[model samples]
Target chain A: MSEYIISLAGLTKKYGALTAVDRLDLSIRKGEVFGLLGPNGAGKSTTILMMLGLTEPTSGSVQVCGIDATMHPVEVKRKAGYLPDEVGFYEHRSGLENLLYTARLNRIPVQEATERAYLLLKRVGLYEVAHKKTRTYSRGMRQRLGLADVLIKNPEVIILDEPTLGIDPRGVREFLDLIVQLSREEKITVLLSSHHLHQVQQVCDRVGIFVGGRLLAEGDIPTLSEKLFAGEPYIIEAGVQPLPDTARLQTVLQDIEGIRSIQFSEGLFRIGCQRDLTSAIAGAIVRSGLALTHLQRKTYGLDDIYNRYFEGGPVYEQTA
Target chain B: MIFITATLKEDLSMNRLLNIVALLKAPPAATGRAPHPFRAIVDKEVSDHLRSWRFNILLVLILLTCFGSLYISVTNIGKAVKPDDPDGAFFFLKLFTASDGTLPPFHVLIGFLGPLLGISLGFDAINSEQNGGTLSRIMAQPIHRDYLINGKFVASLIVISVLFFALGFLVMGLGLIIIGVPPTAGEFLRIIFFILLNILYVAFWLNLSILFSVLLRQAATSALAGIAVWLFFTIFYQIIIKLVAKALMPSEMASGQAVLHYQELILNLFRIVPSQLFSDATTTLLMPSVRSLGPLTMEQVYGAIPSPLPLGQSLLIVWPQLTGLIASTVVCFALSYFSFMKREIRPR
Candidate 1:
């Protein structure tokens, strides 16, 4: 089993009467792309800050790379890289200069820092614009520069908050690819938080869904999907050919026990059923004698699991 | 045992060699080789301030005030010494007037220019960092919070000192060129002391301004608060003190004696205020023979007046007030550092 590289135990942070993060416990293992998925104001940034040792947690403790973050924040910080959500740079400094300053802050020597900064800038596709003041850089370029700054220290664990925010699709893809490459080549642990589930789904090995300052669920995609959907499976097809009406499909599937919900796509039928109803669903499809070209259990994506776990109804309603 | 010791020695040497190689391969320090944290911080602050337009405007304003005061002094110097007058040599005495005689030239400049530079340099020192989103980033480094505040304070003091010396020398050079006669050694020493006091007084204001900057979050608010405080000290504070003294003290005493008694009471009360103490100390330094600004009796003037206190005593007298300014500056900075350390770096 892989050892956990970062751990938070019973962590709680309170601002006056408001609890920004409450009784949070997380354990991220080495070399895993762990995505923190949440909506706005979901305490994602607060959690990240606590991990980075920038904010004091009101209770409990955090350990990064076996070092107690609260007790030894400097050591923890030395081994961890943080990219804040809205990355701000010294406007008077060039992009390369800003990265070099960060490198120096991490105690890197000047000559090597300059060379590494130039290499990172080039890696982020910003070498040509290295000499320009950060104020003149576009949001995308600035975001890339922020990434480059974080990489200057060659940290073991990278904590990126909203890494893809304010970036175009192309930039986002390139960023994701870079992150994947980092994980594979450098054995770096990544904790990425984003509101974009599709992007999270594309890269994360495991995902945690946070809502209202509480982590609702966390698991690999399949495990989370199984938990949220209660092991119910579905079949989906995509094509512009007319399918049976929803009522007819419901009628046909209702008599077959263990089937739960029947949804109709444009030219397809999505059949959701109980854990042991896959065989029954196939039989019913065969009995209906409709051209059953595609019959397979469908896996839920991160979006479906996110919606199931976090949307519409509160996880627990206290009010009568 | 000997074999084990040899293995241990070899391992230690190899580890030391690897550590040295790592240090060599690491990035160079940003400012130069062996970047001292204090120097890096000072250089960064100076460069950043120089790049800012507000600092440029402040520089222009300081130059204008410096040259403006000097020009007025040069034009008015000769008037004090009328042409074909028999006491032309004593015209220098006219330059040292109080209510009894004039003030020294540099003293007048200090009284006028100290606050301008002090308030301008420091009113936005902390607030601008808070506004610019750099405060947290700086604090996040491994350095202690006090280092950041101390570094900034020292950098500002250096900048103010440089500006004062530049202006002081320029004025002295102009005086030499315009007035053909070089100042006496005593006059030159007195001017140098006057410049030192002026810089110290300005440093006091800078400390106060930094205190206000720490208290206020926005740059505009801090600047406005500092200027408002300055205005109260410069204009309304003395008037309030006088009115309070009149209402509180006995007023039916003999006329000239009442003036002396009232002046003493007001001066005492004013000593509690920093600006007043600074002004009184500076005025005393400039005019060595000033007994009082109140009405003076001929008997009292004729009697053997005591010699002026030495410069060390003057500094000792104002030491509490200076300490008060520094203490307040530190208190404000500590509060700011605490709050800044606690504040979440979120979008407004």
Candidate 2:
């Protein structure tokens, strides 16, 4: 029942013969921390740009909060905040000055914009260097300043492309914390694209993995795990197993509905079942007089899903 | 009813917020009413230019050149009163001497200093902005693309006018110190008129520089193009006209008559280049000896290209050339603006 903040329906962008985004259909819910997980040149940035109305889509539609971005980009832009991967600013101006300039561009009153600029600078931990010219700022400081610039308008949706790309570990942690704070406190829907799988896994409530300019898989982490590893069995280890005949065990496990295969090695029996049938198979195993010592459910993480989908695979099934 | 209802439902709060945001987005007001965005862009451009050591040194060099030329005039006057060297005195009097055998008038220094100042101020206006990455940012603003070019053209004109006034004051101060006779009001007005005409001449270069800037993005390339254009009008343009006239005019005409005929042809051809027109206009204004040019007789010179025409007429006579310069500036600006707006801001 969540509100749909942004939607891209069959979005495709082509640069000459190369398709940057191919029929990308995505829906990000209001106030959710959504991650677009993809490697370099996977059309992640292109998709974000299209959503921002900064780049035109070759075909398809982008709607932000029910307003078509292509039809009314300025209106959509007013409602959304975007942080490009490589944020650039007028280097001669001070950090505060740059933010103030962006604020004015965003239409904040001068006095209030100044106050808000100071507050945002403080929030981003850039207050100490606010007076220093941007040319003097480091990459991490610049990124943080870029974030502060986006925050000035108090946008409904925040889109950050590679927000933590060049930051140190500590800076990344702070940046992620701020993103989480924005989503949780401000009720801001966030569509973050990053190559950092671990960070995305840590922060994103739901994620969409894109490979070759198409969404390969998408859902909540556990849901995506289940979807990707569907039909891959759970491994069950028993301590009291003297030995069960492999054929018999396979037969017994397979006799149960949804169990496709069972194999035993090193005092462990691996049972493959239809997704969501793990508990049923485990119950059947318990009833078969096997003392279950360990039970572990295996699911693919973002990295595994990324490699499986993007690297080599069944070529026909690959999204591209 | 439906349309009215839809319009009423349109989020006024959000629209108001956006308007407020737009206002807040402007750069800190440096001068005037936020300078129409293009002005800020042009101001930043001019400031960035004036920051360079080369331009600073150029300004210093100009100041030195003007004063140095003035000093030479003063010392020549001192040398002219040798009492024994009558021919030298006459030579000095003809060129450097005032009606009295004293310091040279302001026009003498202006004649030498004006073109140098005009050429120096305007030869790089557009090219430097393109090189500095300001053109793209300026064009990205909502203001019309032509504004940036026009604003730059206008800004450079203002800068040239200020420089002219500065030079004029310097010469006047020096003239007072050396000549010891304050200029009459008419003479002072004439000097001011000549300075203003020099500004128009500089505008031609500024406009031409902008045209080249749009035509070429590289600062060096635009600058080279501007200098080449200046050289063409100052030197090659006249030579070409002479050669063409000699080939076409009848052999029956006397040499002096042919020369006059060739001069008229060259002047007409030169008018196509705004800088040449500007120079011609200023020369007529500053030098009393240039009473008539080509088919224009002495009476015609007074009626058509007189020394002290009203400001409006002066502007009007050169209006076509000024319009050409202004139009060229606008066109260059429009091209740059359109190209920049359409260009993808992709990371290089």
Candidate 3:
């Protein structure tokens, strides 16, 4: 069997003159959480639709669970589950009834479907509201129910488009954690498409930074940061007391051999360099007889990498 | 580009053929030893309709009108029936068409209300699912997408058929108890055929509303469109047709043949309205004396015996209108089916 559970080869989708997904070539490994990160209208939802065979690509192909989606969509749909953005349910039906309907659509027997529905609802922490009409469900509760709905299929691959949209911050965190735990426990491959960087970073094993219908960069967090900052790969900031002579400090830090750039802002010196120079910088500061109040290395998060790729400008302080 | 599109068209047609073949086979879920997904969807839609206040309200309204007209027809039955009148044999059929002029006959009430029932049932069928965000979720299931639309249409048709048949049989039973006479086999068959024709007429409107639901995005917009079409056909279309007939009326010196042709033209123009077709067909079936829906010339009626037509003769007389109704219903359904298949399920 191929290691890839979901594959899209040169997939392109165009609406009139606009290309929604431009020659997207992506393959998701089995049992891995792959995040497709992009802002709204970056063709994330369009790509997901193509993967599920709900919308045809203008060109190229998609395969899910060893079946060509375009050629045999029903079979691919049978093996894969998809949670659309803002997933909706029959409002009049209870959560259990909704899930039971899905189970019936998947052809599960009524008794077994009921048992599975209850178990999944409980697993999603929605057992208390399992019998409540879905119209009464909150945004977060609906999202959890959506997760249960996807899981009820017992699919090998789950493609979630904006799965955590409109949930509270705490709810988003819990939902992401639940997703990670579930993917780990069930060994289900998940393709989560979201514009939210931190949320994607929390659960995604690998992420593809998408922009304007194209995947700009893709890798694990560290690898992507390393690639983005190949020349000067480290960022460090230090707060010093009893400010030393400016000329003396510049000469000393410039003499450290790998300093690329440095900036003094708000009583702290931010330094960009090629390698670890914490010890060297500390030694220089002590030699100058200035107290080193605070010193630390700054790790690159997805937001930083995204800004670097999109803006191609100086890095800014991380914003939550 | 042309070559690519041609190949794509070929592929699409081939895919459609395969879809049909697969639909003939068990649904994907059926492979897991479960019930057919189409049946499941049908069951869900059936229950939804049965529980909805809209359907219940419409049902109650129709029941009231049906029984009200039946009462009026029964009260006037003895006065209308003369001992020497040959139509005395058709006392049962009059239960539907007879009226005291306060309310219209049962068949007329249905003509006005049947379209409303169909419109209400189907106007929001697709658009509401799409708007509610349930459409994409359901489309992602293992069943063919066509199952959703087909199941809805079938479920609505079933409800309409059951309700109509029940009302028809109930009316017949009531008439039998009040009059103390059983309808002859001929009258029984004619009533049955009339009920079937009513279902067909309602199906025409149901499909038209479904087509609107597929074409329009908002449930409200589709509902309005369905109502607009119904209003035009029921009210404004007749007014316009009457104006045209008056403007084109034959001169005073025109020959009888000319008058006959002019009248036939007017009748044909009126038949364009679905309700007119339905009323004509039901009238011929329910009253069996309607020898011709077209204008009859003097020569045609000069030596003709005044007698109630046999069922076969009545059917033959209304065959054109019947075929027209059936054709239009099928056409509406086909349009909705194709457009729905071609539509994007994503909400904008």
- Rank list by lDDT: 3, 1, 2
Which predicted model would earn the best DockQ?
3
Residue-level lDDT tens digits of model 3 in A112-133: 5675676577668997788799
What lDDT does each candidate get?
A: 0.70, 0.65, 0.86
- 2 versus 3: better lDDT goes to: 3
When sorted by TM-score, best at the front, the candidate numbers are 3, 1, 2
Number of the top candidate by lDDT?
Answer: 3
Residue lDDT tens for model 2, A140-176:
8988988888777777888888989889999998899
- In candidate 1, stretches whose alpha carbon ends up further than 4 angstroms from where it belongs are A235-251, A262-271, A275-297, A312-320, B1-33, B78-113, B176-193, B212-215, B238-249, B253-265, B268-273, B291-302, B306-309, B316-321, B342-348
True contacts kept of 3: 0.64
TM-score for the B chain of model 2: 0.64
User: Can you write out model 3's per-residue Cα lDDT over B1-348, one digit (the tens) per residue?
Assistant: 234224323534667655533332322343566788999999999999999999999999999999999999999887767776656679889888887799899999999999999999999899889888899999988989899999999999999999999999999999999988899999999999999999999999999999999888898899899999999998999999899999999999999888988888888888899999999999999887678888777788999876789999999988999999999989998998999888766732
TM-score each candidate: 0.81, 0.67, 0.90
lDDT: worst 10-residue window of model 1 chain B: B94-103
Chain A: TM-score in each model: 0.86, 0.79, 0.89
Docking quality category of candidate 1 according to DockQ thresholds: incorrect
> Weakest 10 consecutive residues, lDDT, candidate 1 chain A?
A311-320
Clashes of each: 13, 9, 0
